[model samples]
Target: MNQAPLPSYAPLAEVVRSGMREGVHYGAVVGLSAEGEVAYARGPVHDAMFPRSSAKPFQALAALRAGAPLEGTSLAIAAGSHGGEDFHAAETERILAAAGLTAEALRCPPAVPGGAAARKAFLAAGRSPERRYMNCSGKHAGMLAACVAQGWSTDDYLDPEHPLQVLVREATEDMCGERIAHTAVDGCGAPQLAVSLVGLARGIQGMRLSPEGSSERTIIEAMSAHPEYVSGTDRIDTELMTRMPGLVSKIGADGVLVLNVPTGETVAVKISDGDAEERARVLVGLTALRGLGVDVAPVKEHLTTPIQGGGRTVGEVRGL
Candidate 1:
């Protein structure tokens, strides 16, 4: 392992209060990978960090490798943090049904749909949140499917010692090229692994470069083909993948964003303040890609945010 001393974070973006001469908010950016190597890096790349929902792709891949019968939108959702639209919920139900289970089998806490319109409709119908509407339902359903296929008990599938979870840990280790430094319960009640940012980038690159017809490759293709299922309409992940061909992107909670471009470039960014206000994370990631001579013009507008005061545009938050 090429571990190096942790370095201080450098300013990657600045948020200026309206008409202010100085920035009120500052963020740090770390590493960039290309052609299977860490081409650029700053700050501490070896510090343990939780990738959060961004780890879904690897988790879904683990299920597939364990013989879960998932494909197309099902596979995509397995690797997604879906917005819980009607289609997303229905699809979650379908996966559960295919595995001889029900939404009640999911261990994730019940939650309303993440989509604004869907939430309004669900509320209008006098419905309470259900496990099926949880953003992680698809992932949980996939775990159940894998358990059923492997003859593993589904009762405690979310437990770290469960067969399915063991597979997830193994797969994560394989993809990231490092042992997990720590594990903890995720917001969705699944076991989350802590790995270095460099390891996270390596994992994403490994997934992107998986051989054709392999389970990992299947996940990559499924997510790329069904970007909407990976997130939802107007979401950052969905919009980024839709506009950028052959690009794989996932955003974790707390301001972590990872991107894998077609040319074998991988970028991982973390915001120290854990806030993405003004699209700062996206802008920083784009700026890193732009530095590598990647054409980012197509999505630049989408990632740029205008600073406003009293409903009037003032300054703008931009990448440094």
Candidate 2:
């Protein structure tokens, strides 16, 4: 294995202390094409980073390629880090049922809902967290479906040595148009592939620009068409796709965000400290898109987060 140097990140955004006029945080951004074209960039585009859940789209695409019978909301949820709302859980169940499986088959750990209201409702109902309520349940369900479809074993599907995992790794590398430099277990226990920020951008750009009828296109269309299934209400990924036409976005753990617009533009942002304070990833992402001559003004305000202090709006965190 070839070892790569740590990413040399440049400032992509700044968080200022309200009314104090001082920066508190810094991050990096990268914009590129599958063809290795650098459309716009900041920080280190060549260094490897864990894409986390942002890789869900590609993982879903791989499942589709593996003959998973996913469509509509099921397909969208497969590519989502959903809020585990009722609808989200139902959709996940639907996918598992389609595969002749059950929630017990999911390898990811059980967790409360990602949406605050849903979590509260769950606890109020005297219910405990279950695998179905895991935010990654949808993704795991889809993986199970793919296994069933391909006659692969449901047991140990999350293992890196599984055939399904091999397909996922291949699909990820293929889409990124680069080799995986490192691999680790993701939060949900799936294999996490590390690639350059430029590579991440390239992967999304490929999905956005893929020809009609391609699995890549299918994943992109499903996600864009059902943004609500992707992340639930009020989430940045859901809101961005819903409010912006011809746009697909996904948020990963540890402050990673990826966006692709219809015009073949792609952007990826990574906060050095993995702090998603005030939705900084989305703010910086929109800012990067704006720099690429994309008109994000319509949703700019929605993405710009208000910085508060003393229980009042003190300032704002705008893209740098």
Candidate 3:
């Protein structure tokens, strides 16, 4: 592994408080070199916090590695999360059909997508909420399909010890360059693994380094190709990937963001206090990316700043 310079950051108190001031932050940011070594890291608090959707790529890789058949949109949907748009939902349905599965097989929680129009449509349909509408339904569907392909039990596919989860666990550990020290249930009710910020970055780097036939590489390529499907329009994760060349990013609930830069840089950021206010974790992560000379202005513009009506800047992120 190549050792890179580590930069020190001010306390979260300083980084958290912008010129506007007010709000708290709790999280860590870690950068990894192309060689999968920690370049810089800091966290106000660290434990096995849930990575939420940020873990999707790794989990998808696990499914593929477990013998899942994947295609363009199917692979995209596997790593993706549709915004519950008609197209996204339709694609999800098609994927299920191709796999000889159904929405009944999904295990993700039911919720409207991030889009207001989509949410309205969901409500207007008067259809009961099901796992299919859940953003993670695609991932769940993929997992179940993988089980079918591998002849593994889907009874507890989400269990950490299940064959699929076990493959994911090994892949996760291999990418992180460390063992998983903690685990928690994700928002989607799947097992979530927590690694050091550095470990998370290495895991991302590992995916990039994996061979084309490898599942990790497939997920990375899918996500990179379909950044929009990975996240919705105006979503920070989607915008970041779309605007930045060779970058694939995923943001988890509770202020967690992870990115793999084409230059072989991998980064993860988490906020300790989980303040939804400043989006402090993302600010710190973007700043760190910029500090490391990543061209993230497009991402910073879309994600780090919230615009009021008439495009007025109501609030902007401040961090280093």
Candidate 4:
């Protein structure tokens, strides 16, 4: 637990500028470090509430490390996902089968995949909608498999009181280096935890430092190795991993972004007012990572600053 150096940037000015953004006033905390020490911390480092989808890497890893027997597309789908294509659907089925389960066993809501093309394809193919097609279904399937491996009951698996959740909480704390201070329901009808930016950064660092075959490490590797499954082609997470070597990133609902660089730098950002349009999470995250010495050329090249009507630049966004 190395103490972070005081940020050279003035927090008062930073918060004020962020608050003035057109969409919503945003609050963020970023952590950057190498080895086991914290190099910098900004904004409110604690008390940020974010859903758990961003933490899916750790959850999926728990199943892999426990020897649930998944690999190839199945492993890729488990680690990285937005649930939009045939490959994703097939992989979800594969994981379910490997666990001696079926689509019926999934507790996630039934829906077509995320992208418009994926949904159109599903309808055109006359494939009846099933829970397995849901993007988060792969994650849920992986969790259930982990529970099965440990001989935990499959019923009420999504319950906050479930033993699997207890394990998840422990693993999450281990990765973030802090206990979850708040809890809520996720869009997938599963438990979500609230964590600080500092905690999220610590978690990313933990994932990078975690041992091979350890659940946390396994997930970080899988997602890093198969970024496309985590999101789709042209998706932020997918593109970031594809373009930036040795970096893994994920975005949560409500303008949340987390990034881990190969140099062991970790960053967590939350748009305070939750602006869906300004994409303040990406803007600030890319800016911060660039400042911390991440190779941001590709990001700037692929993700350009937006130009306004007068041919003046309004805002900029870095690619994945």
| Candidate 3: C-alpha lDDT | 0.71
lDDT of 3 by residue, 14-62 (tens): 3322255554344578777666566666763234455667777778888
The alpha-carbon lDDT assigned to residue 11 of candidate 3 equals 50
Candidate 1's TM-score: 0.93
Colliding residue pairs in candidate 3 = 26-271, 26-272, 26-273, 27-270, 27-271, 27-272, 175-203
Ranking by TM-score: 2, 1, 3, 4
Which candidate number would show the highest TM-score if scored against the true structure?
A: 2
**Model 2 ranges with Cα > 4 A deviation:** 1-5, 33-36
Clashing pairs in 2: none
Q: Per-residue lDDT tens digits of candidate 2, residues 228-249?
A: 8999885778888988977999
lDDT of candidates 1 onward, in order: 0.82, 0.85, 0.71, 0.70
By summed lDDT, which 10 consecutive residues of candidate 1 come out lowest? 24-33
Q: Is candidate 2 or candidate 3 better by TM-score?
A: 2
Model 4 alpha-carbon miss at residue 199, Å:
0.8
What's model 2's lDDT at 229?
A: 90
Candidate 2, TM-score vs. the true structure? 0.95
Residue by residue across 245-276, what tens digits does model 1's lDDT show?
77888888877888878666888877766764
Write down the TM-score of every candidate.
0.93, 0.95, 0.86, 0.84
lDDT of 4 by residue, 1-320 (tens): 78455323222112112224332234665767666455555566666567457777666656665556766456557655575677777778878787888888888888887766787778988877778778788788887787778788887888988877777777778777788877788888778887777787888788888776765666677777888788776477887888887778887777677888877877777765554653456657777777676767877743333524456655544322
Ranked by TM-score, the better of candidates 3 and 4 is 3
lDDT of 4: 0.70
lDDT ranking, best first: 2, 1, 3, 4
- On a 0 to 1 TM-score scale, where does candidate 3 land against the true structure? 0.86
